[model samples]
Target: MGGLHADHAKPDDRPTGLPTSSATLTPLVVKMLRHGRIAAEHDLLDIGTGAGGLTAIAATRLGSDRVTSVDIDGYLVDAARDRLAGMGLSPHFVTQDATDALPGDYDRIVATVSARPVPVSWLQALRRGGRLVTTIADTALILTAWKTPDGGATGVIERDWAGFMTTRHGSAYPPGLDELFETAREADGENVKLFRYPVTDIRNNWEVWSMLTISIPGIEVDFEETPEGRTAWLAHPDGSWARAEATKFEPPTVHQSGPRRLWSELESIRNWREVEGGLPLYGCRAVVTPDGAIHLSRGRWSATIG
Candidate 1:
């Protein structure tokens, strides 16, 4: 609720304070922390402590003395500090890149940010039975893991959808989108196909599928909107991909391309959709080895990490 813009205050704006999440996902995340059953005495680590809104919640729920928050931006660090102070909560705040190395041992480490392969050092910083929750950017994956005695963690993808700003060691994201799109548009063999998949609404599916895409072959997801229309893409590394466009209705006109027929895969899952039933987008089990291998499952097709 901290640093909430007037426009974002509206119920339709989808506010989560963090980039990839919405207010709707906040309760889910809190539920996850509760299910993990961390002790009241356990230390909590909050990575990418945006405006300290969630940090304040974590402090309240986990105890102020037991929480620590870290961020890469000093400005944000200071701003969040003030916000936390406003709420009369004092959790240690650090201005450092989370991917480097975290300070102190924590029983629950939660990141509202995204990063590359999780560093092995993060595991070292965890006490036994500690847990880590984060979203991956390149693939929009959410990971919730626990530290085991053997140095690996096991958890699950709560949902398959969510996106976060990539962890920045420096200023921010690299400039590559424009060039990449231009290249794709200019390619000579610009053939296109069409289809549709029953994807969980982006607002609610933030954890499971996000992690699944990183390991799956030819399942890249992208979104674009213009005055002309709104569009989404699900591409694969193997050159097979699908595109869905909506100029008016909630349903979109789907287009696809490449050899692997990605839209067909999504349609396979969509055909089984039932009343009050959609493909499992969240609550899928996940396991992360010390070596950084991520595995996700839900009694059907499974996906892995890079």
Candidate 2:
């Protein structure tokens, strides 16, 4: 279950699969494509052409002319194009950042990669009432929205969850939270206390990870098993870091420091979830403002995906 779950690493926060980024799992690909409600007449723009599996399937089902796949890496786009050509499929392929100006009007846009906020550019390129299926960066919430006439979008957080590497503007991603993690690896920290809730394995706990990610964006997670016990580290770009150490059948000792108490924040989210019965991400209705700010609301609970 933990295979591709991630926050910042959304796989990139902790990469897997291909050397560059995690390709959408085949099952998830099929699920998304099906849910995408693709029609033979729909012009589809597939983002993050990793391994080209999704592109191949879409091109096959929708026909190559109806599909346009893009990736930031030219090499990936070129390679995927070649592979598809062998199968007598040639969808339009482009090598550029997905967040940039997307070319062509698309009736359906499905990104295997994640986006922080639904990019405005995407909305601009989408035809009216077009369908878009993508995941929120740093979480596993699959978003399916429709282009609204107001230049925004509205939809829902699908009942299922999936994670893809966050979209990158360049071949290499910007720096990560390495400095804070280095200190967390050893420093005792400015605040040390006992965790009220069980230590969280952000890597594996998809719901909690999604909640925390939505609550506090840019949190990166790392954990390791040692002969002594288990250690989990959470670092944020804002210089906040938390380290928890625990052994089997025992409580964790938490050490945290910085502008925010990362561990306490996680505990708070867990506690809130306990009181609320569960998170509001799944099955929640989402509205992407004309500016691309995604707002979600379900019942009386609400949260925005940044």
Candidate 3:
């Protein structure tokens, strides 16, 4: 999660790296699209046509005319179109951003990118009784919602967890928290103490990290290994930072400072999860207002994101 730059979607051949669009679609993709419940007669709009894995599957299975795929990078669309055509498969490939006016009439939509507030354009583009499958950005929480009568949607955060790259409006993503990570690396403070919990990389723990992203918001994580032990660094837009270090499977000495004690809050959530057996984020109801605000609730726990 640290010391590296990343692309939101899968590998693409934008005159950069990799070859022709992926012809050998992986099982992971098969499962991902299967969750969309693609049927022979279903009209599908596939978002983030990265590597053309899903595009190939959809076109081959449902026929090219029944499937439409879009990507922000025209090069990706062009590359995928040419390669799929080489294999006698051609789906409508649009050179447009997925967040904008999607270029298709679809009864089922599957996005390989995450959306923070689940775009309203998606709802507008989906036909009546249509289904949408995507993830909430910054979290591995999968959302599968169906169109409602009032131009809104209702669904759930699936019991399962998976993710893709976040949605982008251009060729690349915005600048990230490199400055914050630099600050976290060079800072000296006395907020030191040993913790009972082991030094764990929160990013590797899907449930906790996802829930923390929901509860804390705007937190960026970095991690690395050292001769002494493993270290995890957390930073937020509010100028908060926390670092924890320890040997394998051992208690960590923590250092933290800022308006909020980021590590302390994470520990609290972790403890809460332990006491309650599991986190409430999974298997919760997700309701999308017409304006695209997502309201999620499960029993007594609830949160809203826009």
Candidate 4:
């Protein structure tokens, strides 16, 4: 029950035995491909060509001659090429760092995994009216923006959230909890009343949280689970805290850490839900500044990106 499970499932559409670029790609990428926009007879660039599955799909839609694929790993490029060759689709594949200057501009650019922040260089790479679709890091931060006549771009968040590996640059990501597990386990905190909230899912929660981060500033959330229970951590750089533990909803027990009562925040959301019904999220409009700030706008609470 903890791991990923699609309750209302759809059949797997990926080719059997293909090297997947990322776990998030399969159904999501295939569904995007089926829409037939990325493949429409236009020149395109596929960044981070993992195993050529997406490249192969792009080639089928846009013709192999019209698509150019780039990857940081030569071996992966070669392997993806081999896979594409077997499919009789020979897209131009190159072993090069996409963070550097990519040769030639095109109508579209898509990256499966991006570790680097969305650099202004990406905006410059687009021809007027071109589009860029990429997931920022591994978070479900999907950016789909179209070029503006003024040389900037605007886009909306994709419906789902995806986590991807960090870019191969400095300041990638903080060490996982495993690295600090001993510290957290040894720390003492106050026991508090258990508060219950129905979390539909984390994937759809980004719009709300993202909007909150922008507005609240320095607010952060962390999640972990163990045999003991499920836990969510809310912390602020200013030293506020909230911790939730759910072993059973009948009367869950929670731990409060730091000055701020963190469970109270979740409780506030839950109380709102009781009166307003479930909140609407997903497909929210996101505006990225030229300087690489992310902003999520829901109805009343707008979260900002630092």
In terms of lDDT, the best-performing candidate is 2
C-alpha positional error of residue 285 in candidate 3 after TM-score superposition, expressed in Å: 0.9
Residue 72 shift from truth in candidate 2, angstroms: 1.0
Runs of candidate 2 with Cα error greater than 4 angstroms are: 1-19
lDDT of each: 0.63, 0.85, 0.82, 0.61
- Give the TM-scores of the predictions, in the order they appear: 0.70, 0.91, 0.90, 0.71
Report the alpha-carbon TM-score of model 4 versus the true structure: 0.71
Worst 10 residues of 2 by lDDT: 1-10
Model 2 has a clash total of 5
lDDT of 2: 0.85
Candidates 1 and 2 compared by TM-score, better number: 2
lDDT of candidate 3 over 117-149, digit per residue (tens): 888889999998999899888888899999998
lDDT of 1 by residue, 26-72 (tens): 76456545644667788988777766777888888877889998887
RMSD for all candidates, in order, please: 6.3, 5.2, 4.4, 7.6
Ranking by lDDT: 2, 3, 1, 4
Better of 1 and 2 by lDDT: 2
Error of 1 at 144 (Å): 3.2
Report the C-alpha lDDT of model 2 over 52-93, residue by residue, as the tens digit. Answer: 999999999989899999998776777788889999999999
